[model samples]
Target chain A: MDEQRFLEYVQSGGQVETTDRMPDDYRSKLVKFIEMHGNSELMGVLPEREWILRAPTLQRKLALTAKVQDEVGHSQLIYRVVEDLGKPREQCLADLISGKSKFHNVFHYPTKTWGDVGVIAWLVDAAAIISQKALLKCSYAPYARIMKKICWEESFHILHGRDVVLTMMNGTDEQRELVQEALNRWWGPLMQFHGNPISKEDDPMYIWRIKSQGNEEARQQFLDGYVPQIWELGLTVPDPKLRKSDDGVWEYSEPDWDELKHVVTGHGPKTQERLEFRRKFLEQEAWVRSVVLAEAA
Target chain B: MSEKVQKIVEIADDELILGWRDSEWTGIAPSLEEDVAFSSIAQNEIGHARALYELAARELGTDADTLAFDRDPGEYLSAPLVEERRMDWAHTIARHFLYETADEIRLAALKDSDDAEVAGLAAKMDREEQYHRLHARMWRDRLQDEPRFVDALEELWPAAVAVLPEELRPQMSERLQLDLPSNSLLRGFERGSHSEELRPLLDEMTMVRRSVPGATW
Candidate 1:
């Protein structure tokens, strides 16, 4: 089939696997988009993994560890899908560490406290899950299949996050303060987490059906589902204009698109430190990979 | 504390500290698949620590959280082997293989303990340990010929034996085909000793807990 027929097929709910013929644009777009999702999941673990050590309770420690472990697992699953699409996982890691690729804007920031931990799991995972749930209909079959398992594990993370938040919200004034402070810090990135609202027609990812939902649509879903939960705790969101319209659309202040661009381009506060940390391990562990890869060869 | 409580704390502390070290690899392991597999092992160690701490908690009239996070660095009973944060894959895997081997000997002895509760928990823990052992063995076999991996194993072997009691060290050495109770353990961290690595770890491990004293995390 020609480009037009392939486009029509994907737009109308068709799926393609590794061996399927596709337009060059679709293949490259799919590799880049899916690889970024895998990168985001991998980087997302760093902020939370620190808290896994500092978790105040045995239960919280285990929960946080398991949650971070799941993120690593998701990255594994995602990178495998990309590898099948022709990008080796090693190439993906090299590109990520060298700052030649981008992850989600949220992961580029740092995690400050246990409060950041709860807020991330609760809100950040919620935002990610919305995007992931939409990908259940991803035009790429292998990516779509992995999204099923990824979505299932992410639901548990949201609960774990909310549980951490609720426990703090119900505790001492200091504990409550931690949650409020973390929420205040994370609200900005949370808004930007879904990406800028480029038109579906113009966004290559959407045009190819790799992402079944528009960026704005996902943000609206996150607000519609979570703002009430945030409000119920008597916690305030940072935005003054965040509210629901009479027509049921959620409205909020415009996100800093420039900030999003800058951060995703590798200038975020913790990006260098985080990337260096990963590179250190990768270089240190290069021998192990060589041993294993040599055997495979 | 009774001898029983001390012994439980000893093992629990090892698992707690080791798990904390292992988790440092959450996203950065050599391969993504290995990353996930290794992380589960890390989580399992923490889980084992929690269970063992609960048993100790009941005896001490406190709680698992208190035993796990509230203790000072010097108070922890973990061996020196697990105290250091070795992230190198060869060293980490070497430590993993050695630690699991030593733990098998230790757990086996506990299975026949006079205390039924301890023995029962040991049996339960052993069932779960099968996967950890298999994982360690699988990596050992794969990396046996790698020079760095071999160096790591040789360097860490003595430390691994030190993790067991003097009485059990013989059994561990016999299983690994190394000399028993060799004076050459990279350095011995007997049960009562604390490594330089533990304090920095405890500080990070308890930072949030310490920040909001008497509050929920």
Candidate 2:
């Protein structure tokens, strides 16, 4: 099919498979977008993995470990989809470590306390799941199918996050303070997570139906769904202008699009440190991969 | 503590410490697939630890979390094998394979315990551990010819035997087709003494719990 026909097909909700003929732009765009997602899942775990060892209870430890495992599992699934699209997982990892590709802006920041853990699982994953749910309608069939499992596991993560927050809120003043402090620190990244409020018509990801929603639409959905939950916990949102309009559209102060662009471009505070950490491990373990792959070949 | 409770806690401590060490590999394992698979094994080990702790908790008037996170470093009953920090894949897999082999023998013995409760819990844990053993065996197969893996197995052998009681050591040795070390050699690495690693591990493990004393996490 020609590029125009392929565009018309995907625009009307048609799905594309690996074997299907398609335009070079669609295929390349799909690989880039999907590879970043795979990278995010992999990097996303490092911030939370720090807390796994320090989790306060056995229950929390197990739950957190399982959650991190699911993320790594998600990365495995996502990278496989990327691999099937012609990019090797090794190439993806190399590009990620070398800062030749990008992950979500949120993961580039550091996780601070147990409170950060709660906020991340609760808020970070919430923002993530909104984007993921929208991808359930992705024109890429393999990527869309995996979102079903990814979305289901992510629901449990949000519950785990909320549980951590609720327990802290119900406890001592110090515990509640931890939650609020973490929320305060994380509020900015959470707002900036869905990307700048680009219209779907112009965003190529949306133009090709790689994602089913606009950037602003996802950020709005997140605000509409979560702001009430945040407030009902008697916790304050850091944004002064964050509120619902009479027409039911949620309004908030403009997020720092500059920070979002800078972070995803690998200049966030923790981005270099995280990439270095990943680079160290990947280089150190290169021999093991060689062994396994050589034996298989 | 009753003899039965002490025995249960010993095994629980091994599982808890081993699981903690195994989980340190969550995102940094050799491959993403291994990271996920290894983490499942780690979670299962911790789950087994919790179940064993609960069994002992019933007799001690405490709960599993209290037993798990609230203990002093010197008081933990884990052996030196699981306590050592070996983050390298060779050492990690060696420990995994060796510990799983030792645990299989230990659990089999417990499954025949006269105490029905102990026996029942052992049986359930064994069922879950089947996967762990399979995973360890799969890695062992892949890495069997790799010199580093072979060296790791040999280096960790004494500590692996130390994970078991004197009587169980023979069974582990037989299963692995390796001869047991002298009683004196094994005795030095046995349970009852805390490794230098355990104190630091315990400090990090309990840091959050200690931060908010007595608060639900």
Candidate 3:
């Protein structure tokens, strides 16, 4: 199919299969977007996996481990799609660690407390699930199909997150403070999680139908679903201007677009450290893979 | 604690701590396929620990969570082999293979325990360990020729032997097909010795609960 025709096809809700022909730009963009997502899920594990060891209770430990495992599985599914699209998993990893690619902004920050843990699961995951659900209609059929399973698995993460947050809310004043403090620290990054506002027509991801929701729309959805949940627990958002409008738009202090730009471009406080950690582990295990996948006689 | 309860706690602690170590690889294993399969093993270990704890909890008049989190590090009976925070992949896999091998032998003994409760639980846990063994064996075969993996297994061999009762050591040694080292088997550490790692882990793990000491969370 011609480039213009392919664009029209996707715009009109046509699904592109792996076997289908497409413009080089579309395939390249799909790989880049999906690879970054896979990278995000892989890097995301570093911030939370430690908690599995320190999980205060058996139930919490087990639940968190399972959740983290699910994220790993999701990344696996994602990378396989990327691999089929032309980039090898090794090349993707190299690009990720070499600072040639990007991951989501939120994972670049640190997880400071168990309250941070709860916040990540409850609010952060809720925000992510909103975006992921939108991708269920991704024009790339394989990516879209895997998203179905991802969205399904994420349903449990939301429940687990809500349960943790609810439990903390019902607990002592210090516990409640933990959640509030986490929210305060996380609000800026969370606001930027969906990226800065761009018109659907202008945003390539939206234009290509890889991302069905616009950035502002995703942020508003996050607010509509979660802001009330936060308020109900007597927690205050750091932004005073944050409020839902009569027409249902979420009004808030404009996020630090510069900071988002800075962080996503590899200057986040914890970006280098987290990437280095992943790189170190990957290097250490390189021998195992060499031997494991070595030609069987 | 009753005799039966104490015995179960010993085993439960071992499984819980080992599961924690295994779960460390959830997001960062050698491959995605191995990550998923390995994670299921980790979850299964925790599940086995929970079951054993519940059995003990009934006699101790407490619940599983309380037994899991409320205990002082010194009170835990997990072997040092499972408690070391080795992030190195070679050491990690070595310990994994060794522990699964030893655990299978111990579970076999327990499957025949005179106590019906212990025997039944061991039987159930054994079935789950079956998958764990398959995974470990798969990795061991793959990594056997690698120098780093061989070194790791040799270094950790003694510690793996200590994970079981004295009488079962021979069986474990036979399964591992290695000579019993002259090095002293690490013991007594289970109840009194803990890696410095436990304190920090507990700090993060309990941060939320500690913040609201009497609260529901």
Candidate 4:
């Protein structure tokens, strides 16, 4: 199909399959966008997997392990979509390690304490789910179908996060302080988790219907749903300017778009270390893959 | 602890530590499909540990969390075989195949124990472990020809046998169709001996819980 017709088709809520004809630019854009998501879900595992080892209770350990496992499963599901788009999974991994692609801004930061654990699962994932919910209407039907399961699995993470935060909030002063301190560390990243407030008309991801909502719309939904939950626990978000307006739009200090740009381009605190970790395992385990998956090739 | 309760704790610790090792591959498995599949097996092992811990908790007057996290590194009763660090996929799968083969025999004997609770939990565990056994055999069949996998199996085999008592180990060998190495040829860690690795593993595992003692996680 021609570019104009493809655009019209996607904008009008039509779905495109893997084998469908499309403009070269649209296919490239879809590959890049979807590959980064696969990268994000895979990269997302490193931060949480550390806590899986240190989870305070067996129940917490199992829950955290399962949650991180789900993230990995999501990555697997996502990368398959990317692979179907013509980029191989190994190529995606190589690009991720080489810093040629980006994941969400939040995953680039370091996770500090158990409190960071709760806040991440609660707040960071909350922000992500907001974006994922919009992708249910993604013009790429395969990507959209995967998002359905991804969103469903993530539903527990928020509750698990809340349970963790609330229990700590109700505990000793030290425990409450742990939660507050972690929230302070993570707030900036969480605010920037959704991209800058570009208009949907200006954002190609939105114009092509790869993402069904504008950046600002998803962030507003996150703040609206989660701020009350945060406040009710007597916890504080680091943003002094963060609040809801009379008409219900969340007005906050403008996110450090420069920092978002810098970090996503591979200069965050833990980016190199995380990438190296993945590279090490990928190399160390290459033989296993060669042996197990050789026949398919 | 009573021998019966102590036996339960020993088995729980084995599952707990091995499962922790298994879960190290949550995102890094060679294949994404295998990563997800392996992770479920890891989760199942931990689930089995939790159930076993709960059974022991009743007799010890503590909860599963306390028994799992409050104990010192030296106090964990896991086999020395599971205590060693293993991240290589070949080693991981090799150990997996060996451990599951032995676990099947171990669970079978427990399923006939005179202690009703022991016997009952064994029956449930066997039901759950059916998948683990199947997974192990499947991987074993696929990787049996790979030299590294074959080498890992030979290396880890002794430790795999050490998971069971001498009385039940012959059955493990019989079913696996491999000769059980003499105890002296096996350099595997003994049941009563915790490896140097176990201390650090336990420390990392309990770091968060240790930070705020008595705080709900």
Candidate 5:
């Protein structure tokens, strides 16, 4: 099929398999888009993993550990999909370490407190799940199939995060402050989490069916779904403009496009440290990989 | 603490500390499948420790969180094997395989104890230990001929012997398919033999709760 026909097919919700032939440009775009997602999931683990050790209670500890486990699991599934699409997992990891690839803007920031834990799970993951759920219908079958599992696992994280927030909210005043402080710091990143809005017709990810929803649509969905939950607990968002208009569109302070560009391009506060941490672990374990992978089982 | 409560505390500390060490590998293992499988084993070890702590908490008239976090670092009972932070995969796998082997002998002895509570708990723990053994063995097989694996096992073997009761030493040697250590087993790993690492881990782990002490969370 010609480029026009292939575009029509994807726009009409046609699914593509790995074996199916596609245009060079389409394939390249899919690889770039999906590789970034895999990178995000992998980087996302670094922040949350700390909380696994610091969880205040048994149930919270178990839930946080399991939730972090799911994030790693999602990364595994995502990388496998990318590998099947022609890029190897090692190559993906190498590019991530070299800062040659970008992940979501939010992961670059530090997770500072128990409150940050609750905010990340409740708001940050809520934002992510919106985009991930849209990808459940991704044109590439392998990537889409993994989304089903990733989205389901992420649901647990949302509940765990909200539980953390709500419990802290109902506790002592000091506890409540933790949640609010985290919210204040995180709201901007969360607002920018879905990336700057682009029209569906113009976004290449949308046209190629790698993303079934546009940037603005994903952000709005996050707002519509999570804003009430946030406000009901009496926590205020940093942005006064963050509200839904009568027409059902969210009108928020426009996210800092330049900031998103800057952070995701490897200049965020904690990017280098986190990547270096991953690099150190990989380096330390290189012997194990060399031994096991080389062995003829 | 009462004698019974003290025994519970000893084993509970060992399990909890080792579980914490195991969990350090959750995301970054050498392979994706190994990462997931290893995580489950880590979670189970922590789960087992939680269960054991809950039982001990009842006797001590406290809750699991209090038992897990409120203890002084000097009060922990983990063996030196679990306490040493083996971040490298070679050492990690060596400790994993060695500990699982040693634990099989200890759990087997507990499985037949005169105290029904101890026996019942041991039986439950043994079931989970089965998966831990499978996972440890898988790594052992994968890394059998590698020089690093061999060196790690040799370096860690002495501590591995120290993990089990003295009476069970022979059984552990048999289970691991290696000769017993020529030197006497290192002792003094029970409650109150805390690792220096526990102090820091506890400080970070308890920081949130301590910040708002007595709060519901």
Candidate 6:
């Protein structure tokens, strides 16, 4: 198929499979978009994995472990999709570690305390799920199909996050303080979690129908759904201008788009540390992969 | 402690510590598939630990979380085998395979316990462990010829034997087709003594709980 026809096909809500023919632009765009997602899931694991060993109870420990496992599982599922798109998983990792590719801005920051854990699962995941839910309508059939499972598991993470926050809120003053302090640190990145409010017409991801909504639309959905939940728990959002307008649109201070650009481009505080950590493990375990793959061959 | 409670806590400690060790691989396993698969095994082990602790809690008038997180490091009854911090994949898998093998024998005996509750829980745990055993065996098969894996299995054999009781050692030896070492050699790694690693593991494990004592997480 020619470029215009392929664009028209996806524009009309038509789905494309791996075997389907398409323009180079759409295929390359799809691979880049999806590969970043896979990288995010893998890199996202580090911040939370630090807290798994320190979970306050057996139930929390098991739940945290399972949640981290789900993220890793999501990475596996996502990398497989990328691999099917003609970019191998190994190359994706190498690029990610070498800082040649990007992941979401949120994961590049540090996870400071137990409170950071709760906020991340609750708020960060809430932001991510909004985008992921939009992807359920992706013009790529396989990626869209996998989003069903990813979104379902993500719902559980949101619940787990909310429960952690609620429990701490109901506990002592010190615990409540922990939640507030963490919220303060995380709110900036949370606002920047969705990219700048780029117009759908101008966004290639939207043009190709890889993402069904504009950046602003997804951010609005997150604010509308979660701001009330955060309020009900008596936790404060760091943004002063964060509120709903009379017309039902969310009006907020502009996020630090420069920081988002910088971080996702691999300059966030924890980016080098996290990428180095992943690089260390990948290199250390290279022999294990070689042995296993060689024997399987 | 009652003999039954002592037995329960011992098994619970092993699962708890070993699960803790296994979970260290959650995000950093050799491959993404292994990361996910190995994490499930870790979670299942912790789940088994919780169930076992809950059963013992009923007899001792405590809660599972308290038993799991509030105990002193010196009081932890985990075997030295599970306490060693071997983060590399080969040692991780070697411990996984050996611990699962030992646990299989221990759970089988528990399933036949005269106490109906103990036997029932053991039966349930055994079902979950079937998958864990399969996972361990699959890795063992894949890496059997690798020298590092073979060396790990050899180095960990005595500690693996120490995981079982004297009567159970023979069964484990038979199952693995390896001779049990002398009891004298296994005593140092046996239960009832905490490995130096357990203190730091417990300190990190209980830091959040300790930060705000008696406050519900």
Deviation (Å) of A20 in candidate 6: 0.6
Q: Candidate 4 lDDT, tens digit per residue, B1-217? A: 9999988999999999988888888877887788888888888889999999999999999898888878877788898778888888778889888888888888998999999999999999899799988988888888889898899988888888888988998898888888988868666466877778898888899888888877777
Give the least accurate 10-residue stretch of model 2 chain B, judged by summed lDDT: B181-190
**What lDDT tens digits, residue by residue, belong to model 3 across residues A152-206?**
9888898898888888788778877888999999999999999989888899988
lDDT of each: 0.89, 0.92, 0.85, 0.88, 0.83, 0.92
Ranking of candidates on lDDT, top first: 6, 2, 1, 4, 3, 5
Candidate 6 residues A1-297, lDDT tens each? 889988899999999999998888888999999999999999999999989999998889989999999999999999999999899999999999999999999999888789998999999999999999999999999999999999999999999999999999999999999999999998889888888888999999999999999989988999999999899999888889988999999999889899888888889999999999999999999999998889879
Q: A98-189, model 1: which lDDT tens digit per residue?
A: 99988999998888878899899999999999999999999999999989999999999999999999999999988888899999988998
Shift in Å, residue A259, candidate 1: 0.8
Using Cα atoms, each model's DockQ against the true complex is: 0.77, 0.87, 0.67, 0.79, 0.68, 0.89
Candidate 4, A1-297: lDDT as tens digits: 788988999999999999999788888999999998889999999999888878888888888888988998899899999999899988998898888888888888888889988998898889989989999999999999999999998989988988989989999999999999999888888888888888899999988999999988998899999999899999887889987899988899988899998998998999999999998988888887787677567
Give Cα distance to truth, residue A14, candidate 5, Å: 1.3
Docking class of 5: medium
lDDT of 2 at A78: 97
Q: Provide the TM-score of chain B versus the true chain B for each model in turn.
A: 0.96, 0.97, 0.92, 0.96, 0.90, 0.97
lDDT of 5 at B205: 71
Instruction: Provide the lowest-lDDT 10-residue window in model 1 chain B.
Output: B180-189
Taking the tens digit of each residue's C-alpha lDDT, what string does model 5 give over A1-297? 888998899889998899998888988998898889988988998898887778887677778778877887888888888888899998998999989998999999998899999989988898899999999999888889888988888888898889999999999888889899999988888888877777898888888988988888888788888888888998888887777788988888877889888999999999999999988888777777777767755
List residue ranges in candidate 6 displaced over 4 A. Answer: none
Q: How would you encode candidate 1's per-residue C-alpha lDDT over B121-193 as one tens digit per residue?
A: 9999899889999999999999998888899988777678789888888788788888765464445556677
